[model samples]
Target: MTAVKIIKVLGTSAESWEDAANEAVARANDTIDDIRGVEVEDWTAEVENGAVTEYKATVEVAFPVREGNP
Candidate 1:
């Protein structure tokens, strides 16, 4: 049978939430292959001086299970 594996990843950026999410996938790509999709699970931020200094995203990344891996 074929299956997909899902994992969680966190990404942060100073630009925007979208950037943060993209960063998660980009970083995950470094170690994972055949990335099928991603789901944004949560959003958070770091604030300084009454402004958002950083944006953080919790992402669920999906990829096919390797042939020999469980």
Candidate 2:
């Protein structure tokens, strides 16, 4: 049997939601391995002068559980 663990990550982008999600995954991949999937939990955008300035996304990242060395 295999176990999976989930982690929450928040990322910001100046363009779109896709960029935000990609940013989150890129950050998680920096220190983690065997990344399984990503789910967008929430999204928000910042506006300035009646224009969208930034897009933020919260994602749930899942990875396979690793066994500790004995």
Candidate 3:
């Protein structure tokens, strides 16, 4: 049997929501192993003078728990 865990993270980019989601996964990869997938929960934008200055993403990352470890 395998176990899975979910963690929430936030990422921001000046590009787009897709970039922000990618950034979230990339950063999580730095510390997390056995990553299975990511779910983009929400998206928001920061506006500056009626223009989108940044894109923010709320991401849920899923990873498999190591065997023989709790």
In candidate 2, residue 36 scores what lDDT?
94
lDDT to native, each model: 0.97, 0.94, 0.94
Which residues of candidate 2, in runs, are more than 4 Å off?
none
Tens-digit lDDT string for candidate 3 (1-70): 7889999999999999999999999999999998998899999999999999999999999999887666
Per-model TM-score, in order, reads: 0.92, 0.92, 0.91
Q: Taking the tens digit of each residue's C-alpha lDDT, what string does model 1 give over 40-66?
A: 999999999999999999999999988
Per-candidate alpha-carbon RMSD to the true structure: 1.7, 1.3, 1.5
Task: Count clashing pairs, candidate 3.
Answer: 0
Superposed Cα deviation of residue 63, candidate 3 (Å): 0.3
Window of ten residues with lowest summed lDDT in model 1: 61-70
Per candidate, the number of residue pairs that clash is: 0, 0, 0
Model 3 scores what on Cα lDDT?
0.94
